[model samples]
Structures are given as structure tokens and as C-alpha cells.
Target: MASNDPDREEEAAAAGEDEDTGAQVAPIVTLSEVAVTTGEEEEDALLDLKAKLYRFDKEGNQWKERGTGSVKLLKHRETGKVRLLMRQVKTLKICANHLVLPSVKIQEHAGNDKSCVWHASDFADGELKEEMFCIRFGSVENCKKFMETVEGIAESSEKNEEKESKDASDAAGLLDKLSVHESKTEKAPEEVPAAAVKADDETEK
Candidate 1:
């Protein structure tokens, strides 16, 4: 016995309620968004880039900041929004007077055209370390000078080491030969037989 009009009104009210709630609802995209929505697909291409080696010498005890590498920036395609690209920063403590210097060589896989090196030194007591670090990047020509310098130093050091080793070996051999000669010369002269001396004396008599 319910009236058709009342049933119609109830349905209309339900539709209005749904519309009100829908207008207030806001859609949000969280960080868990899928890669497709992040719009950073192009950035992924650069992710495989090999890190470059940057070298510098630090005094036995000092703190220094190293700035050697590309500064990444994210540019939004549509609005030209630029976001600073985040990178990893590493800090090491100087522990030796003559640091063997760790390998800061950029992997061959890295682009030579895009690579660059930065060198810095910090000294204790607020004095800058007299030592310098050389950073190399870009074209082969860019690194040519530094490479040549390193080669020269290495060659010089190698020559010195070789000369020292040869000198030591030569000195050792001379000492050995001298020792053998002395052993032979140290033998006492053969003693004359008493019988031979008596024979000589008899002959004289």
C-alpha cells in the first residue's frame, strides 16, 4: 500500500546524497605510485651511468669536502619545473701521511665526454694541505695533461727503485767475491820439511 510518489522521493534523496559525497572526495597519488605515473622514465636511462673516479690527497688528519661529479637536475616536461637531482656523497678520513690514494678512476662504461674531476685538500690547524688532487674528465685531451704528469712521476719513481735494487745487488756480489779471495790468500805458506833442511846442511858439510 506504499505510495509510488514516496518511493520516488526516497530514490531522489539517495542520489543527492551520493552527489554531495562525491563532490567532497579528492583523489590523491601517493609515493607508492607506479613508475608509469611518476613521469621519470627518461631519468631511468641515466641510472646506469658508471660513477667517475675523483682523486685528491688529504693530510694525515684533516677534513675536506669533495665536489666531483655531475649535478643532476630534474626538469618537468610540461611546466619546466626543475628539481635538483639527488646524488650520493661520500666522506673519508685521512689516515696516512702519504695516502696510496684510492682508485677514483671512472669506469670505462662511463661517458668520457661527460666526466669531470675535482681536487681539494684541507689541512689540520686551519691550514690548507700543500698537496693537491687532480681531477680528470671530458675528452681524452682534457685528461692528457694530468695523465702525462702522472706517467712522468711513475716513471721516475720506477727508475729510482730499479737503480737502488741494482746497486744493492752489485754491492752484495762485490762483498761475496772479496770474501772468497780473502779465504784463499789467508792460507798459511807450506812449511819446509825438517829432513830437507838436514840434507841441505849435510851437503854443505
Candidate 2:
């Protein structure tokens, strides 16, 4: 058993050597993962679907592809307001951001069953601009769903606006009545008291 090869034994000993020196190397710079906010925190997504978005270029007179990603209809929890949001697929960059106002109109794009068009005052690019937008879905059902959801939100927003207007009008009317009553009350003091009038007559007698 002692008749072993020296080279083999040396190689085995080398292989058995612990390569870790037990000294840890510290990183030159440490980076901690920071949380990113998408500004959608206070909203709840009502509808989310995979879709492609487009914008009509007035100068070119043709629709331009915006992005392909998930489009969402987000409703605020407290305000009950809804907005349409679409971000680029990989980048997660917002391509469309606009509120679903009462004036919004979404219709099926001409000759496209799986697509719908709408107009919105978009603020995604940091400036408010009146934009004509079109969105296409993989299925006709998704397209219909997007359109229906948007239009329903618009209708609800319109009703809320109308109700707010009526309430404001009623408040104004009540305030006007109170103001008129105050004016009458102020002028009522100008009329002489009956007892004062009688005392003046007696003094004159």
C-alpha cells in the first residue's frame, strides 16, 4: 500500500487544498433595490387588457402606433374618477394617460371590429393636448370591453357632474333666500314701534 505514485499524491493533495482563504471581499459599491412608484397607487384598476394603442397625427393624417402593452382603466377610490392608462410593454413607460371626462367618446374604429377610437385630453407627455386615440385588442371581446368600460365611466362622470351642478344651484338659491330675509329683517327696525308712536302722539298733544 506504500508503493504509491508521488505525482498522484501531490495532485490529490492540491485538489484537497481549500481555495477559500476565509477572507470575504467587500463590494466596492453596494446598491439597494429602491421601490418605484407609478402614480397609480391611489387608484384601482377596473379593466386591464393586453392591447395596442395608437394616436392620430393631424399633420400626417394617419394613425401612429403608440405602444403595445397592457391598457388599464383605473378609478380613484375617493374621487370615483376614472382614467385610462397604457404603458409600454417592457419599459413600463406611460403612453396614454387621461381622465375619462364626460365628453369622452369611444366608438368602434371604422372597418376594424377589434379596434375602437376615442378622443381625450391626454397629459402623458407632460402637456395637455387634445388627442385622437385608437386602441386595438387581440380579441373583439376585449375591444368591446374596453370601449364599454370607458363609455360607462364617462356616463357616470356626466351624471355626477350634473348632480353637482344641481346641488350647487340649490345651495345658491338657499343663500339668496337667506340674504333676502336678512335684508328684510334689517329694514324692519326702521319702522317705528307702536308704543313709541303712541308716546310721540301724546307728547304732541
The per-prediction tally of clashing pairs is 1, 0
For model 1 the TM-score comes to: 0.33
Question: What is the lDDT of every predicted structure here?
Answer: 0.44, 0.92
What are the per-residue Cα lDDT tens digits for candidate 2 across 20-81? 67888999999999998889999999999999999999999998999999999999999889
| Tens-digit lDDT string for candidate 1 (122-182) | 2422454544333334556545544444344345545666877999999999999999999
Worst 10 residues of 2 by lDDT: 184-193
Best by the lDDT measure: 2
Return the TM-score for each candidate structure.
Answer: 0.33, 0.82
